[model samples]
Target: MTPANSDGCSPDFPDEALAAELDELRQLLDGTDKPACAEEGEGLVIMRLCSGLTLQEWEGLGARRDLRDWMALPITANPFPYLTRIQQTLKELVFLSEHDPLTKLHNRGAFERILSAELIRSSRSGQPLALVLLDLDNFKTVNDTYGHPCGDRVLETMGALLAAEKRTYDYAARVGGEEFALILPGVGMVRAEGIVERLIESARTLRVVCDGVDTPLCVTLSAGIACTKGKVAIGWEKLYAMADEALYAAKAAGKDRVRCAPIADLTGTPEKTLVRADEKRFLFTGTTKG
Candidate 1:
């Protein structure tokens, strides 16, 4: 994908520089290549996991929490066992409907619906969110090298990797035959790339064992990242295009690395949307330039 510039020059993305800066911050924050969850760090996580939930989904989560408390009751302690059992059955049915049978991640239909909801939520909250499009590199080769059964196993492993890596607020989905996506609410581009980079590190070491063989094989992935330009909400289609373009860049540049959408020029720009009241005062009261 060609990187877009403010002046319509070369396709060099504006936010390209932020990657290194965030990497440095990542180093300082964790002192390692690993990604940390919100509870593990002060910053660097999404705003909230339930930001984009519909009324029904929200109530479902509430019911889930309530059930967890009730689940702890002794077998003989619960007078009405039917109630918890019914809820559990409903939750299971919902899960089966919304999630892919293989990867156990959100299926394409569910993902698109959630994407729209998330964009709206991000817009209302006035915080940036990221959408990442990822494809397994040379996956056909892996399938050919092993077998279709092995290919399915690889897909399953990737699904697990995605689910394991993302925070509770983030969303993971299998959107295509081999294409997957991650929706990160309230996370900007810089932090988004950092998260995906750590995912890359983890995938680099993955070795899935196939049937009838002791030797395990590895897989590499290419990811493209796009963040909301600012508080202004763009359609999910546009956002996906930006991420798809970046994904093209990753594939063109070489597989197994992450690329990002063009960043809006944050330099010398007034902080209207994402700044605190005190920070806005600080911006207005900055040292006068000569």
Candidate 2:
């Protein structure tokens, strides 16, 4: 008795056995949504599932052989749904790895990697790169007086502002607790200072309201900026350190201000230039691009 469905094409088997075989085939195809390729070799049909799936992933699923053998069965099923699930999972994992869970900004690790890559690109292209470090003013007071939730809201607000205000190519990240970093590719000191000045002005206008607060909480941000030409000998680490020093200077001079490191230090010799919040002009007494 040849086992066959209404098409009458297989070994003579009962309907129950045919149904079970079809179920097994369906289960195998369910593993991935990619269009599986069927190849015939030595009287056996091998089905390969998932185009982008690596050998390691097949091993992890422990269903490589099962899928191959199941696809050999005389049954047809679509695997697109399974592939969609796998792709969605991969996207979520990658996002969680590279982004901060709190602020939804790039995490410190991602920012460091981006900065290093940008440094290499800048070196090759001979374009200037600028780094800006920002610290929240009296952030501790927000946490102490309002609570951690309120503090979180404030951070979220700052993160939103950065995302909205930064240029399309700018890389902004929440690099540390109450601290953020921005990488400006192809931007020099004067232009970088202008951007930071606008950021300072924007920070003043940010107001976050939380539960149990008498009034909306407005926080201030102090920034330290450092810029170097693309061909400069300085690396990302040195650039970040200089920006951090400038940020410290800003805090010392007065919170809610923007400070800039000396252009000479970045160019050749180390120098310091403090830009006050009330400064009318971004005076650069140092070297200019030729």
Candidate 2 RMSD to the correct structure: 13.3
lDDT of each: 0.75, 0.76
Q: TM-score, each model? A: 0.62, 0.66
Q: Write the per-residue lDDT of candidate 2 for residues 97-176, one digit (tens) a residue.
A: 99999888899999999998998888777788899999999999999999999999999999999999999999999999
Candidate 1 minimal-lDDT segment of 10 residues: 46-55
**Candidate 1 pairs with clashing backbones:** 1-249, 3-11, 49-169
Best candidate, TM-score: 2
Error of 2 at 234 (Å): 2.1
In model 1, the Cα lDDT at residue 145 comes to: 78
